[model samples]
Target chain A: MSGNMNLTLKIWRQKNNKAKGELVNYKVADISPDMSFLEMFDVLNEQLITKGDEPVAFDHDCREGICGICSMHINGRPHGPKHGITTCQLHMRSFKDGDTIVVEPWRAQAFPVIKDLAVDRSAFDRIIAAGGYVSVNTGNAQDGNTLPVPKTDADMAFAAAACIGCGACVAACKNASAMLFVSAKVNQLAHLPQGQPERMERVRAMVAQMDKEGFGSCTNTGACEAECPKEISLVNIAAMNRDYLRANLLDSEG
Target chain B: MGVFSFLLKSSIGKKIIMGLTGLFLIIFLVVHCGVNALIFMNDGGVLFNEAAEFMATNILIRTMEIVLFLGILVHIFQGLYLVFENKKARPVSYAMTNGNANSKWYSRSMGLLGTLLLIFLIIHLRHFWYVSRLTNELNANETLFDEMKEVFSLLWVVMVYLLGMISLSYHLMHGFQSAFQTLGWNHKKYTPIISAIGFCYSIIIPLIFSIMPIAFYLGWIK
Candidate 1:
């Protein structure tokens, strides 16, 4: 109880996709600053269960920040007040003693709230399925030395491949645009020799699916890059734009 | 959809159109400001009048004027469409949003600033373009410079012009480099140069435009 803090929480509580949601208030005491944000939620849920009340529902997997499932729009930000982090990676220490926190689900037409702080981000799955991969016949792996990808391209491709498929970029963007997420997927593939066969078609099909998902258009505001947990650069977006343009104008296979 | 329809309907395609038209308008601003600065010569508007006469009568300039109008129309309509779609993307609004945490206020407020500029454009066209080109209201020997002087003389009109210029400044601040980025021109080597040029352009061009109204109203140029 020495450094433990008591806090107030305003959390969005929604029943289901069709139901309306409201921010319900609660209180927690003796919260240790060392606990991860999700652990803090675990404590809250335990408290609710003791009181015979329904616990707040949220999404989480691999609290180590990789699975990209943890999502909480906390205190008017995607993953609390931290930069370049997922909600699971945030710790209770980020808050001051006796602070009031607000948490909500990602609000976008393409990402509907499932319950409480969880949203249905299957839209990203559909986009990936559209063309976020390269097709190759089932055979032995090709020799890595055979295709000598330049150092610069490999580095850029690796950087872009770091995207965790989190919807934080959409949550941070004013337009709720999924450009950062979609572009990351596009650039990761487009930079490698393995992606050359379907580079043009991938950009075209992925963009079409992204638009169909009702996500807003990118305005080059850079919010997505600023808020990305993996620190994915906005350059991915520019590259995707370039690829999409070439696909539309120059690609003869269209 | 075919390529043409894709260009018209796709989200990225719409943005490309916005970027292209925005760059065109940015160039037009430079030319417009350069020509308007001729008033500083203070040669009884003689040089300014000659330049205005040539701009009015030159066949190439006349044709480009039509193209310029079309660009403006496309930019405005496309911008409005994007704003509408963006709003719909998040129909269930957040209870609290701190947009300033990740992006600049002007970058987030492009639609609002652009709307203000549209209002300014209407007043601007009526004051100068309509009087000199579309109407016979000006007597013989009255130049476009005369109309500017008469218009800027009004305190309210001068205030409106100054407000318009401020809005234009913020719009360009976000728009100039944004146009380049949307066009996929972002490069580590060239983007910094583009951003630097954009920053200077956003300030210098709008400053020049603001000075025209202030100079006329304060009797600095007359």
Candidate 2:
């Protein structure tokens, strides 16, 4: 309380996708430096509700950075100027006493705004539905070492599997493409022995779903991986490409 | 429904369509650039013009043109669709954030650059294709070299060509790398190399294409 600081907040407010929204300003005081950015917002929201005003709406879950649900463009940067942490994991100490924080949702034509600080992320689920799953059966409850997958393949699969299905890749992409996300999923499946059974079919289905989901084509801009909280490599994207090519060529020839 | 749905519904299906169409267009550009480069090869404009004329009338080439048009349409449509759905799918966020510092500039701006490239394509086809078909059709005696020079002599034409090439380059910057990723060639060891290749191709192709018009206009070629 002795070192508590006052901060200015400019936040986006919209009723829904079709409604107009503007950044509303507010002043918050006595905030702890150890408070997370979302915690700071929580304090602000508590005050607003006590004043009988509608609380600001935002999306957050599993604040630990695993759910891929936290996304905010703070002061013009995604995830609030952090290197690899989500908004929930971001603490107040990153800012000073008098700093002005501007908060907004992911802005893109594909990501039509649903409400203030909330956009529809079901596009990702649909993309996954298009072909993100592995249908191969390798027998359950058996020894993990039975398959004898190469360590290299296992490592790559682990990395690719790290994707949390966040729309950050889409938000970060200039074309608003989800190629990185889709390719990660595809590569995760393609790298392991289990993934080999339906490798070609998997890539074919996933890429098709990504396209159907209205994501833009990849432009080789490594923005997705750079913004990825998990730091998933672009190597997965290339691997997805090789498999996709082989699948297409084989599909056509055979 | 099958064709339309296949384009809209299937990820690999969409990519295959996209890749095939893109590859075809790339082939066209390479050959077009190669033919234009002929001015540097021959002492006069004779070789390039003859080649252009033959290409314009050849039955095989004519068939390929129809395929090319279809490919362009599919590519554009699918690309647009993907952008739309990607937005719709990710409707909510868990928290507020900012820029993706790790990704490539081309990947993020592909759609915007692509829109620019589309406009450029229309203008380019109109100027080069329609004009060549109607007015310049009878200029068989004029070498492709002379015709290109005449076209490039206009400052506006040079600007348009330059802009067109730049857009194409931007498109390639993303398109090349993206196509590979969708196919699952994402090995950590090879990705950087592939991205480098994509960058180089994007820059070189446009640089070469843009130079041809400028060279023809500057009297760099006979």
How many angstroms is residue A64 displaced in model 2 relative to the true structure, after the best TM-score fit?
3.7
RMSD of 1: 1.2
Query: Where in model 2 is the C-alpha error above 4 Å?
Result: A1-5, A14-22, A30-32, A49-63, A67-69, A105-144, A165-167, A170-222, A237-254, B1-8, B53-62, B80-105, B134-137
Residue range A84-172, candidate 2, lDDT tens digits: 77888888898888999988887665567788888787877876777677665567755978778888888989988888877777777
* Candidate 2 chain A lowest-lDDT run of ten: A245-254
Give the candidate number with the greatest DockQ.
1
Range of the 10 consecutive residues with the lowest summed lDDT in candidate 1 chain A: A137-146
lDDT of 2 by residue, B88-170 (tens): 54454324444444554555566677778888888777767777765755564654455567778898888888987887897
Two-chain DockQ for model 2 = 0.27
